[model samples]
Target: DAGVTQSPTHLIKTRGQQVTLRCSPKSGHDTVSWYQQALGQGPQFIFQYYEEEERQRGNFPDRFSGHQFPNYSSELNVNALLLGDSALYLCASSDLGTGGWAYGYTFGSGTRLTVV
Candidate 1:
């Protein structure tokens, strides 16, 4: 019954560099979603993965990509990062498919990325 966990609670990077963040989904969950939350803004859906395939994605650039493994964990990779990429990267977990409100999406505290 573990909750979602993200690695490197805080991170600092420079412009034009690449960074990868890891996430472990809650137990008994097969779906993982990534979100980017800027200061004082609601989380913006970056992408969602189910069955190891991307089911939906938002209007992010190609630089934002992700992968979901067999164990339902995930990793988000950003290449050629920019200052604008500095934000709270969140990883949420849910059951396969969507239906109930309670089991929809449970978000982690997130990995704070700071690009200078």
Candidate 2:
């Protein structure tokens, strides 16, 4: 039973560039959510995906998008990145029916994106 996994643990991109972060959900998990955490700030929800559809979204702009695969894996895509986008992008997985209360969510180590 592997936990959520994210790729490119660290990344650096110029302003206006685009980046894609990937995640694989933990076994038995069916929902995937993305979050952004800036320095000294708590994680901000980006969006969540389930059944290969966008189930819910946060206050992020349209530039922040995501997709969920049939296998329950997911990807977060950021376009026209800004310096403010520099942060730790975390992926969390949970079962839809669990309401994320009993077992809680499993989070990835996150991808550190630095926009210069």
Candidate 3:
């Protein structure tokens, strides 16, 4: 089955601009979560979606928002991006009520965003 995928593999943007990243969940999964991982740092969850609704969220500014479609794909949007916003954006997919895969969530490589 196809695993999670994200694009563009990399991004470059200026401060105060807006950016949107996309993600497609693994086959048969119904939940998607967005995370931000700074260089050499662990991922910080931005939000999670299940059944096309925002089921959970993390500690992030309102500038960080996301959406999950009925097809289980998702998009993350950041407004007024700052240099600090530059980070590797990761998209994780899970089975929702099914407790995910045996090894837990399936994560995409990531979208490397560089805000200058």
Could you tell me the C-alpha RMSD of candidate 2 in Å?
1.1
lDDT of each: 0.91, 0.93, 0.92
Question: In model 1, which residue pairs have backbone atoms overlapping below 3 Å?
Answer: none
- Clash pairs for candidate 2: none
Question: In terms of lDDT, which candidate is stronger, 1 or 2?
Answer: 2
Candidate 1 error regions (>4 Å): 97-102
Q: Write the per-residue lDDT of candidate 1 for residues 11-102, one digit (tens) a residue.
A: 99999999999999988788889999998999999998888889999999999999999998999999999999999999999887455226
Q: On residues 8-68, what C-alpha lDDT tens digit does candidate 3 reach at each position?
A: 9999999999999999999988889999999999999899998888888999999998888
What is the per-residue lDDT of model 2 for residues 1-116, given as tens digits with 9 covering 90 to 100?
78889998999999999999999999999999899999999999999999999988999999999988999999999999999999999999999877752578889999999999
lDDT of 3: 0.92
- How far is 101's C-alpha from truth in model 3 (Å)? 7.0
